[model samples]
Target: MPRRAMLRSAAVAGTAATLSLVPATASAAPNRWTPEELKDRKRVLEAGFTEAEADCWLLVVRATAAFFALPELHPLAKPEVVTAVHVIQDKLMMRPAYRKYRAANP
Candidate 1:
């Protein structure tokens, strides 16, 4: 896998492990990955994406999921929410998490 992919995977695994402690109904508005996201992932993979590319796509999808998980989002404009979500997502899915995930998964 690409360096970025490894890092991203680590972050995802770490974040997921942490989040797993929370119940599905932990929040009234739990972020759910919709069926459309599954379809989109499949589409990306079928288009002959490299592993890193697919992981990048996963980051986007996961970020959207995280965005929905935020309770303060409803008060913001759509564009603002999008910007905030992406920014936060980037932070959460960076090298530190990636390293942790890679160590455990490997």
Candidate 2:
């Protein structure tokens, strides 16, 4: 598999993992989204994002969730960490072979 495909797979896995932790009814329903739900929403948005856009939005979700899940990472003030990761993921998604190779590898 190519490096780009690997990166996209990692991002998708990360996003899926994060989504799994939240209850399905949270954001999909009427109430205001919990912080966790917001984070998940952000992750979904980031997952669909491209590198040219504000890719940091997705990173914010992942980093925030990571910080919440593992306080040891201490991602308190690091708002842009998730964005950086999303940018990397987006770059990988742009590669023509990424999706094809990802399907084959997975």
Candidate 3:
């Protein structure tokens, strides 16, 4: 599969898996998101997304992080894989619904 396609598949699969699990609340200390994740959560909430949407977006973010950590993506010195990974990550930063929220808020 193409790199982008593989990444998309990973995200979709991850989202499905996450949806089946209980979601973590922002106030949950043990389940607290990373600092960067907290920032993203705040941004999405302020952008008018519902709690559920923010949760899903965070899951997508996590899914991409896992994808990047895969063994296949090793050897960061490879020019082609590095460029592809960058492009994929940039696109994944905002899902379509998240974009709509930001656009509406802006």
Top TM-score prediction, candidate number? 3
lDDT of 2 by residue, 26-103 (tens): 333324446775565555546554332223333444455665575444443244435545665555456535755788
Error of 2 at 101 (Å): 28
How accurate locally, in lDDT, is each candidate?
Answer: 0.54, 0.50, 0.60
User: Largest lDDT belongs to which candidate?
Assistant: 3
Off by over 4 Å in 2: 24-29, 33-106
Can you write out model 3's per-residue Cα lDDT over 1-106, one digit (the tens) per residue? 9976676566545545665574654335325678888788788788666666676567656755676676664453244444544454445445656778888999
User: What TM-scores do the predictions have?
Assistant: 0.36, 0.29, 0.47
Against the true structure, what is every candidate's RMSD?
Answer: 11.6, 10.2, 6.4
Clashing pairs in 2: 56-83, 59-82, 59-83
Global Cα lDDT for candidate 1? 0.54
Pick by TM-score: 2 or 3, better one: 3
* CA deviation > 4 Å runs, candidate 1: 1-39, 83-106
Instruction: Give every collision pair in model 3.
Output: none
Q: Candidate 1 residues 1-106, lDDT tens each? A: 9854565556556555654554343443223435776576567666655444445456556656676776764453444545544554565446445766799999
Candidate 2: residue 100 Cα off by (Å): 27
